[model samples]
Target chain A: MERVLFKPLSQVAICGGTHGNELCGVYMLKELPRDRSGTFSLTTVLANPRAVDTCQRFTEKDLNRCFTDTLLSDLLTEDSPYEVRRAQELNALLGPKGSEATMDLVCDLHSTTSNMAICIITHLNDRVGQHLFKYMREKIRSAPVRLILLTSPLSEGYSLDCLGKHSCTIEVGPQPHGVLRADVYNQMREAVDRMLEWIESFNSGTVFEGGEVEGYSMVEKKDYPRDPETQELTAVIHPQLQDNDFCLLKPGDPVFMTFSGETIHYEGDELYPFFVNEGAYYEKNTAFVLGQKQSLLVPSISVEKEQ
Target chain B: MERVLFKPLSQVAICGGTHGNELCGVYMLKELPRDRSGTFSLTTVLANPRAVDTCQRFTEKDLNRCFTDTLLSDLLTEDSPYEVRRAQELNALLGPKGSEATMDLVCDLHSTTSNMAICIITHLNDRVGQHLFKYMREKIRSAPVRLILLTSPLSEGYSLDCLGKHSCTIEVGPQPHGVLRADVYNQMREAVDRMLEWIESFNSGTVFEGGEVEGYSMVEKKDYPRDPETQELTAVIHPQLQDNDFCLLKPGDPVFMTFSGETIHYEGDELYPFFVNEGAYYEKNTAFVLGQKQSLLVPSISVEKEQ
Candidate 1:
């Protein structure tokens, strides 16, 4: 059996296949040579084995959603026939015992409900996080990717969020059933390569000067609770994203709005035009795409990554 | 043996003995009759039997953190073990199975690390959430409650934030060897009674027109990652709230600040003296809670909750 070998001094631990259906990262890892050749070793763990076998997002539970210290420990001990054991196995590998080697960076690859482009999910206040965010903007500014949603600290408690540091979830577009799409796979590959390059540069004494980090306007996750009586869509309007017309918006901005006209307004000083697609406004597929109507007219900022 | 009763019409579920050592809620539930027979019925579940038997917080996992959909399902499955079986049994009694029987309130009473007063945990959104926040403010107006740190929606995925609605974790402080102090217990009792009354008023078509609903300065969770190498506390300072005088910070002001000193100041248009605590300016805690320093004198503005 070929084993996944990582670089001894690798500071980052990038994992995909956390949710079995989100396999773009897994395929990318599979394509890489088994040995990293000491160029900052990369170890890839296919998180949920059973789920992967079934080509399902998860077997019993959303593994990404169950990363709290308590839940992780429980899965480690409990005896059951489920994918949690896979999660436990991966956790042990990632969080090795008595090893001072803590991951300085973690990128959990995922796919959203919409066919959006690449996005880097990081905490706003992290220097390294900001550095990576800036680097992505510089590298992939021309992609169909629109706005990078800054998840309010309150709404971030998942795998990357639970990691409690410069961990981010690089969201590719929505999953394509059991098979990986060519575009998404390529995009994931490119993103991983770029991230690895950035890590190498940082380790080799390259300076990552920070840039003007953009704050995300409130993008509320709309919940459509089925009506108990009718079992029909009750049209629950959760106005999570406050539309800021002053900030420059692009064509593919991820807008969270209710079918109703209730919209959240951006309070920042700048005003930008709003973008909209009339037909795909309400469906989950269209609603989750990242786009913007106005373009940020702010001065170009530079970010430096240091070793 | 007293049978555990399940009630759904009542929008309340009282679970005690989650932490075996701090079994105040357990004893309290036992002291009360099986059925309180109030407008809101109460269904009590003993979260961990093994933990309770061993007198510990948990046997293998912290029960409070194991409230995800998957874990709940695992607990409900027939072949599950002790805690999982108990969880299943409890779910049959209290899970969000029946549409009409969905629980609107869950009071997870817990003891904390300090000797502070009672702390109510609720999302900054939901009307009931606001009601609880206001109730706590009214209950301990002048008491040395230290600080009412609003757990960002990003902290606990099982919290009201993930519920995408409203829920609170009431931390009754000064746990004496994993047990609640007498005063803390009294405070919990009073707070629960008041909260119940508020809920009753809400159910009877009586709106809680207590006062103006305060706006929350939203903070992202990822921005506050603990440094991997230094292990030092870190957070993204929302650009809006940096370096500005915090004027007119009432018990319920939603102050939002970014690491870059940008301040998003919003309060009902009233010019009030903002207070600041310079000594308590540590990470995780509020920037204004350090010590008494020069407070901000700013013109207050009136803002309403975005419906």
Candidate 2:
């Protein structure tokens, strides 16, 4: 197999607190106590200080959805949302978006209320990302780490990680908003440690042989059933389905339970559910997302020497 | 046993959304759909509309703490907090605290992030409350229902339930903020049903017998380890202690895990911990409250007729 070569990573950025109330990432970046003098120059940032100060998800709009190119170049005025202005400032610090000056890698830390374990969410079919993800899955044993490939292209990505030349998002959870769990935080730290280890080995001319790795590609999202008048959810994720992320959801499986004590079942083809009962998504109207499993034939990769 | 007598509950209020984000209570009150035409007149309330509208805990101050007489009587001015203003309105409708016009019973519904199943929180040693709690415990079978005797007297209580002549707080849990779980909501609904059933039986000249019931009484609260300079939490509830509410904590038992992976142990005498890893209490500077277990020797009670 031909090795996919790339120049050694020169600059890498890590950010947290994109949604502020996701405390695992917020604290990880704020209290990182290590001498990070490594082969790669590292930059750490708190993505949303205003929201983190009050432990709110965001002030005006979700900063995560503000990173798209269209929003990045939008005219800035006093009436602009707080996240829009902050996103521009962040773009200046770590990114210019699709430019040579962008950081070599950007790894954003996120947390969710769902019971999905550590998830590596990245753009699909990127050899560099797949190899790194394979390394992380093999190395981290503290939690069951899984992969999720975004269906959209990198150019259309809206997350903060999309700012880098090569990017990956490390989302760890089951921790509630505004509450930090020691195990969740430690799992994220361990994953980051493993990522850094892989980066150093790649930069030092070590060849990583990759064959096959399994990942989930997002198919569609399902919102909770709601009352037409109130727009409030009329049903809740069923107890049988709650916290059962990454499990195959089949047709006729119980999915929701209405307030009147009636069970609602899934009517679609077999697909795996993720992000079941995420608290933040309650307002977003999303109950869970269904994903289709796929096998990625990752290729061997090594660092390319500077010409 | 001598039958303790009281005038049958006349005006009853069941309130929810006091702490806005506790959805178990919020939805139960909003979606209560049954023939509630009974012996006792019932008034349902959605407390703190401003906060509930945005799915936040509160807008200006915790409404639960604003019911204190001092705050309720504080001169309503332009500078008063939103909750203080709301508290005054609530007092006028349901209470003139320490007066004859207050509702007969104000049973407020609440939910917690801790796994403290269905908890009946009430003022300690009130015969009427004890008998009703005993009745509910015997009737409800879906969830483990327990009792919590508030250490503070009703005169000094700050909760919304204090507005009633006789009040009880039904707190159910393990549900995250802004997220509703069907099981938790159903547990609360069952409790309210049992309470109404008790009320009807008591008003119909039925005698209730109670011997002893197990309950927990309040003790000191412990805060998470913090960095003195930054005031940011330095540790989180240990994996061993997370979700283990109502479990005993003894000297040398692991209580917290530092961000740097060190375990901190409890140093106090054996006590049960409740509200373990509660998300809202994180900002209140409380990790969990230690409780002392007690056995209440309750007396028989019956309705006191117009005499």
Candidate 3:
């Protein structure tokens, strides 16, 4: 039997295969060569090992969504052998109540169902998340990325969200079952390198001024269809927005109009489209800039001799 | 001469020998042991090294206060060949835009004029700060410690404050010139170890639950008193208060009336103290337990034909 032991080292967590089908993140982890570099004092772990083996979303529950304090504690205490054991193992490595080698960052890797490029999901208003996201965006500026979504608030019981305030989820685009794309792998590797570099810079007393993106925006409302039989909510997306398309609308502009046999009436600006294709929702990239209104600008004036 | 190359590594940072009389932190760093089990990824830098040799606060300006982005950036881009070159070296190790290996943590060690236990100054509502503070409290529970104060609302332009979020300022009590305290060194070493443990925990997917200590109150309210002749603000501390003392007043309580020579009168259900001790301003421990109100309990008759 393999001996279960705890080594006194800095830990690095990488979570992949949360969707059961996506493989890019997993492949990247498996392929990345571990070298002894003075970059990061790293201790890495692969969460949801069983899910990765079975190629299933989850066995009985979504492992990513089962990271609540109560659930994790209960799992740790229970006699049953489950994935919670992995979490307990991680905790042991973190040490007793007073041990100093605690977590600094948690990067959970994943892949979306849609064919979008790499994106990072994290909390809004988080300093580390914002800085890292800006750094990552600049690292991969020329990619077929749809949007870097901030989905922590929407999904409360997420693994990375529960780890630390600085934790983030990296989502690579759709990958064929059991196959990882080279582009996605390269991006993930680059991100990991960037993270290590950031840590090194911090320890060295050097300032790392991450790149400045445009800004951030929030997703106020999303349109969905209703089921005909049960009248329950169902998946639906209309007026699919293209990348970087800025939506311009004045106050009180009609946003949603009900269709009645060709009659298209106006509806109030309850859900105005400010910037279409604002990208995925994440904490740091939550806000995005909109086109400046011409009316709001003050007209330039010529100065007199007094000026 | 050495190559003077900028090597980006995770190493410790030591600063503040302004007064030739105060050098506890500097000595501690110089005497730190190199042999350890876990990885010590750090970049070591001696801020104001010249001051250390000269036994002075500064030659031109207070280096601690010169942490603005513009000033630092200028130092990085200037034409001078002295400290500017050092700044350039530090930046190269920190990495340029999109460079991997950024800084992970920074600790600006210093010694105060007054005698007190070690204290960590960091921003409130910051997860990293909370985690580090909690870990330290747990480790030093058996020590001869008075209390751990968390200084918040940090004024701008301090090195650690300007650090990439996960940074802290460790202040040690007054020590004789060029003297090293074993206790202080051990405490700092333990703190650094705990920091690494935190990073490991985070990397291994262990969630860091902050202590119930919600926040801290400022000890001093009035601005630093200026010297009569120099008219420059001088550091001053109020009288220390005992733990669980009666000097603190609840929120909205009159500050003048409580501090005046007159006796305090209370008309409400209960009056809670606010600022109590010399350095005590507010409650740093915010966690509390839920208790049942006395009015909620009732005696019930038995259901056996209850006559």
- After superposing the true interface residues, what Cα RMSD does each candidate give? 23.5, 1.2, 31.5
Residue-level lDDT for A27 in candidate 2: 80
Residue B262 deviation, candidate 3, in Å? 83
Chain B only, TM-score of each candidate: 0.57, 0.97, 0.57
Give the 10-residue window scoring lowest on summed lDDT in candidate 1 chain B.
B273-282
Per-residue alpha-carbon lDDT of candidate 3 for residues A1-307, written as tens digits (9 for 90 to 100): 1212222114455555554435555555554456667634554555666766755445546566555555556634456445556555544553221234445566777754233456665555444555566666666664533233353442254463346435667765433233333344555666666666655554444444533343324445433233478532222111222222334433444322111112122233322233221212211122222322121111211112111
Q: Sorted by TM-score, highest first, which candidate order results?
A: 2, 1, 3
Models 1 onward score TM values of 0.38, 0.98, 0.36
Query: Best DockQ goes to which candidate?
Result: 2
Q: Provide per-model DockQ scores.
A: 0.01, 0.76, 0.00
Worst 10 residues of 2 chain B by lDDT: B30-39
- What global local distance difference test value does model 3 have? 0.42
Error of 1 at B140 (Å): 67
- Per-residue lDDT of B240-290 in model 3, one digit per residue for the tens? 211222233343432221111222232232232222222111112111111
Model 1 docking tier (incorrect/acceptable/medium/high): incorrect
Stretches off by above 4 angstroms in model 1 are A1-9, A75-83, A96-100, A145-156, A160-165, A215-219, A234-307, B1-307
Best by TM-score: 2
